[model samples]
Target chain A: MSGREAILGNIRKGLKRSGPLAGTALELCQTRLREHRPNLIPARAQLPHAGQVELFVQMAQEASATVARVTERAAVPAEVARYLADIGFAAEAIVAPDASIAGLDWSAAGVATEARHARNGDRATVAPAFAGIAETGTLMLLAGPQSPTTLNFLPDAHIVVLDAARIVGPYEDAWAMLRSERGEGWMPRVVNWITGPSRSADIEQKLQMGAHGPIRLHIVLIGD
Target chain B: MQITSPRFKQNAHEALGDAALQRALGNLKAGFPGKRAAAVARMPEFEQLRDAARDLKNHILEHLDFYLETFEANVKRRGGHVHWARDAEEARAIVLDICRKAGAKTVTKGKSMITEEIGLNDHLAANGIEPIETDLGEYIIQLRGEHPSHIIAPAIHVNLDQVSDAFHAHHGKYGKTERQTEPRALMNEAREILRDKFIAADVGITGANFCIAETGTTVIVTNEGNGDLTQTLPRVHVAVTSIEKVVPTLEDATLLHRLLSRSATGQEIEVYGTWSSGPRRPEDPDGPAEYHVVLLDNGRSNMLGNEFREMLRCIRCSACMNHCPVYGAIGGHAYGWVYPGPMGSVLTPAFIGVEQAGNLPNASTFCGRCESVCPVRIPLPKLMRHWRAREFEKHLTPQGFRFGLGVWAWLARRPKLYRLATQVATRVLKPLGGKTNRIGSLPLAGGWTAWRDLPAPQGRTFFEQWKDRQQAGGAK
Candidate 1:
């Protein structure tokens, strides 16, 4: 027998099942998978939209990411430029091909942005987050044509633009939003839940930032 | 990779005496458990979350076949391949075949205990494929040609100066001959060296923290982002995990993730939680072109229905080890296997054999700290006792122990004889107490009293004292 068959056979024997579940067990398993019921949502995540965004900003900062709030979508370019100037960086960045970012006039804000994935020498990548999670101050980025996964990594600095409206209370809510947007059965190739800049404590348990990914993660929040 | 578990007593004795290992083990108390306590204090519902996590795993284990089949189907739907391996050799063969098909000259690896369990690096190197460990700790241990001492912190046994020497010896050709004394500088040097390996590698292999059956996604949580670079930069990406890692949905995975990082490092979440479902898309600028998953079940299938079934609920959090007093004393190397601490004590016997690993279960103090801190509530102490019971039943325990326990059990069955025996023993040993009221040494108990004195029996046995108090009409 194949390895798959033998392994599955052992599992069946271990479970003491003569065959697959016939009625309730099978039905319950299918229903649970389809429903995807979340267990024990933290009370901290049960906040209003404004409160959630506030919590997200607070948590993101606590995780060592810089957060800047802008009033509108058009203001994102200027905010990115300001953050770069404040951090003593160049005006150039590798921007994601997402239409939301592509349509923005970055050059108008005195920033030279190219629409592509990050390369070895890329200093920064400007991308749009699918959602911002308030519970842990995390940014949810889905991989696709608009938001290449490489843009999340493979760069010295990562500049993300998250709309305040897109912020959710926790990871479960983020999953629900994805189901609603992409349909229940569909999933992106990659789902990145980035809390902050990369770090390592392998040496003497001393934390040093920017291990392999971005050294600085500056979030440009597109709302009050 | 080798089972040196039968020599556990000797290994532990040596580990306790090793100056360098003792110094490294000193950091365990100051590091792991405190952060976990603080993180748990903030979340009021953390206990409830643990229950939820435990139940979900139990649900999946009962219907593992169905979930595995569903996971395979989803991966196929997303244009990925899933290979099932009944044991270690088959798992190694499947991974080697993938590397050969990819024509991989060099493979970059993320930190994976499963890889350590299967001895993947040696296997790949024997087949003329260079495997580079990208994680900083794993890299250090790999350089020293040693197995991981700790699951999460592979090089926890190595000190800074040792890391410096290892790097200096190997990095001479890279124009980095100067020894880096500072941790920051050492980390930067590793980053610089591993950067080239990541870009040049033909294949990447990582272990999945969870395999979501709903979307066919493999999730990896890492603070260093090495796992990310390993999976993303290579032409082919392969995830090697055990069969028990499969979960039903992303929601379930998220709850477990909430507990894992906090318990492991006291962080609310890891720096990066990357989930890869398949290979890169057509319009994607960069990512692996091919994706594969190798699911290995060396002995987990047999553990499913047995007394050790709860062991499968382990998330590799290291909370059990961090809180383990024995682990704190001996460090991970003394456990003499891939896993250590309370979890290892129970699991080692299952993976290896009771005869070879009986010493591990016997090594515990039954402090119950590991089970209390366990997010899944594994009842690790109870499991260890189960192993001890099995060992005794199979006559794996030493003859001396059997004789001693048999004598005690035979005496304890008759209450009157037990009282008489204890009273006589107390009377005989009272004079030996001396001014210190402690026994410095005793026959058959030299092992226990070698380090410290055992307290002598005070005035009388409890039975005699109780009878005297009753005669004096003491308070009931």
Candidate 2:
């Protein structure tokens, strides 16, 4: 028999063995579905509008949060160099890379940026996502030719550059767009949708951001 | 590991006494449920989405076989292998054989409860294959030689100082030059140390959040992106998931996804929602060369026909645990199993013997909080009652407790006699009442009075008061 047939056979045997209450249990499952509905935040509201992004930047500035901006078409190498210089990230700090970041002058950038690598050092290079969700202020990165998964994590301060035009309304829209783009047969093994930095409330309920993930999230939204 | 029900009380006592554990548990108590509430409040349609998700799960469970078949076919069409394991032994054997065939020296794993259930790491280790847990929480627990304390937050019982010590002790042996106390420094140390393992590991293993039947995809949601790396970089990717994880279509999966993140960490979604269908095709530039999915039954199939089948609807968001007062006080490790909290209390007996887990069901205060907070509304307190009934049927209750309950039931059945006896007893005990108007001790009620005093009863019982009111009305 085919592998599918084997798996089904196993499932059938399991159901049969689970005994009499299985039917009632399943019915109860249906009842629960009818009863307790959990709330879900819509994806559209999660994204910040163009006006909201401006206000957000202003708010960040007012709050004394370090903010940086980079233009999309500018040479990535030079832009990365300027970003590092401004942030005072040493040239020798470890770097992370997203696969989408291509044709960059790594040596000229003067920072040791590893491609598709997760290292412990302070410096890293990553491909910025297209848009940041204003509601959660999340950076969504599709794992494809241009973006690598490593750069989003494995750094103290994460610097991401985004193409403002590529922003979408919600996570579902991104998924729908991804399905349309990739089609039925081929799906990327990993699509990382990141929000803010790594955080944990594991210590006395204190909101300690960046527990095991990036401590600082720097987004460079490139205007058209 | 042999985890006993008695160990729960012991472990809880030890945990309560430890300042570090108390600190860690305090963080979880304040953070997870609070975030979930805020996230829920933000969305007007959150309840609707949860209902849809729950309905979708129920529908899928009804035709689980059909969906599993579709999923398996899709996976094969995409060049992935699917293995069927009827029980834990079969599951472990299948994984070990795969490792042996691949000549794998090292395996990097994402957090998989199924793997824990089947003892995959132990199996691999016994066979001389090193299985490395890459999730920081899992890694910490592994280094400390302990099981996961909580389902989602594995190292919930561990504090930063303990983590620092674990890192200092372990990383030093692995060539780490520094002992760091700060959280950032420790995280960096782990990242640096694990990076090489990720790059060099021959196989990657992960647990599935949801398995879609329509597209034949297994989805994993994670915050750290470790699961993504584990699935992508390795030459071989193996997914170990329970059979109940299957959903009919991407739409159904999406419905569940809406509830999963909100219930889990109060986020709209986790940092990463990865879908891996199969191995890489010719056009793909990067991915695992081979993909395999092991669908494990391991006593879940039996649950399908049982009253406890609703347990299968668990999305593992841990909402019930987050809200349970008993779970909150004792924490996950005290439950002493792969699953913990209300879910574990119901599940452990089913997986192991009911006789061995008698204490688990009785552990609850029956506050009904678990049932209320459950995203799927499992009615956990009722399930515990069912277990208690079963325990009684099996004559598992102690002889003395049984006799006490029998005498109490007899007295409760005859109101007049019970009232007279109570009245006489109250008059005799009135002299013993202290200045606090409390009885400090009683012969048969030492258990109640040991930790607290019993309030002195009023002279008249409810029945006597009611009779007096009736006589006055008649006379008037």
Candidate 3:
């Protein structure tokens, strides 16, 4: 027998099922998979939209990411430039190829941009988040042509822009939105939920930031 | 990877006397447990979530075959390969076979306990492939040619000066001759050195916290972004995880994800939680060209049917170890395997034989703190007792221990005789108590009195005191 069948056979024997589930058991399994219902949503995640954005900012800041609110999409370039200047960095960043980011006139705000995946020694990468989660102040970025996975991890500074309208109160809401956008059972190659800059406490249990990812995480919130 | 668990008592005895390990363990006791307590305090629904997490795993275990099959089919749909290994040897062969097919020269690895369980790196190196551990903790231990002492913190046994010595000795090739004592400077050195390997490695291997059956996705939660780079930067990505890691859906994976980091390191969430479905899509700019999942079932399938079935619910959170008083005292190396602490005590006996690891379950104090802090509520103490029973039945325990147990059982059988003996003993030993009412040492119980003074017994036994109180018409 194949290794797959042999292992499954042992599992079946262990669970006391001679074979696969049938009738009600099979139906119940299928229904549960299809439904994909969440177990229990934390009450802290059940907030209004404005409240969620507020909580998102608060939590993101707590996780050591700097948050800046911009009134409109056109204001993102200026905000990015300002953050770079404040950090004493160059005003050039590797921007994601996402249309929302590509269409922005970065030079108008005195910032130079290379719209592609990040490479070694890249100082920063500005990308658009699919959604901002309020519960943990996390940014959900799906991998695709517009959003390259490398742009998130290969740079020292990660500058993310998320529309306030795209913020959700819980992770389940973000996942549900993804299922609805890309049909059920269809998942992106990668779904990244980034809470803050990378960190590790491996050295004497003392945490140090920028452990193989962005040292500074700058979130440009595109609304009040 | 050798089962030194047979010498657990000796190893623990030596660990208690090692000053460097003691200092490191001192830092560990103050780190993770306090953070977990604070994290739990903030989340009012944390207990409910743990119950839900445990039930979710139980449901999956009952329907393990269906969920695993579904997971495989989903991975195939996403253009990824799923390989099953019945044991450690097969798991190693399967991984090496994939590396050979990929023509891999050097492989960069994310921290994976399963690979350590299968001894994958040694297998790959024997076949002329270099495996680089990317996690800071795993990397330090790897440099010392050591296995992980702790699951989450692999180098928890190594101190700062030791890291400095290792780096100073090995980093000359990379033009770093001076020893870096500061954690930040040392971390940056590793980052620079590993950056080249991540960019150049042919295959990247990682462990999965959860394998979602609904979408055929494998989720890896890491505070360091190294797991992401390990999977994304290589030409081939292989996720090595066990059979029990498969969950029914992403929602279920998220529910457990909420509990894992909080329990492991007291973070609300790990900095990076990445879900990889398959290889990169044609439209993607950068990611692995091929994706694979190596699913192993070394002894966990057997655990599903036995009294230790609850052990499969473990998320490798390290909470059980951090809160374990025994683990705090001796550190992880005393357990002498890939795993340690309460979870390791139960798992080591099952992974190896009860005979080889008979001393592990005996190492516990039955403090019940591990189970109390366990997010999945594994009943670790009960499982250890089960192992102790099996050891006694198999005659694996020492002759002296068995004889002592027999005499104690005989004495316990007769209540009157037990009371009489205890009263006589207390009266005989009463004068030995000094001004402090504590015995400095005793002839037969030297082992107990070696480290600290033993509290002296009062003149009367509890039975006599209870009878006197009853005669005087006590409140009870």
Among all candidates shown, the one with the greatest DockQ: 3
Q: Fill in the DockQ of model 1.
A: 0.81
TM per candidate: 0.97, 0.83, 0.98
Residues A29-143 of candidate 3 have per-residue lDDT tens digits of: 9999999998899999999899999999999999999999989999999999999999989999999998899889998999999989989889989999999999999999999
| Distance from true location, Cα of A197 in model 2, Å | 3.2
What does DockQ give for each predicted structure?
A: 0.81, 0.26, 0.89
Scored against the true structure, residue B97 in model 3 reaches a CA lDDT of 93
Per-residue lDDT for A164 in model 2? 62
lDDT of 3 at B15: 94
Residue A34 accuracy (lDDT) in model 2: 35
lDDT of 2 by residue, A89-185 (tens): 7663333344335545568767565555444453555565745544344556655445545565656677676666655554455555555676734
Candidate 3 residue lDDT tens string, B1-476: 67788889899999999999999998899999999999999999999999999999989988989999999999999899999999999999999999999999999999999999999999999999999999999999889999998999999989888999888888999999999998999999999999999999999999999999999999999988999999999999999999999999989999999999999999999999999999988989999999999999999999998888999999899999999999999988899887899999999989888988888899888989999999998999999999999999999888988998999899999998999899999988888987888998999788888888878888999888998999889755
Question: After TM-score superposition, what is the CA distance of residue A58 in candidate 1 from its true location, in Å?
Answer: 1.3
TM-score of 1: 0.97
Candidate 3 interface CA RMSD, Å: 0.7
lDDT of each: 0.91, 0.72, 0.93
What candidate 3 gets wrong by more than 4 Å, as runs, is B466-476
Evaluated at residue B257, the lDDT of candidate 3 is 91
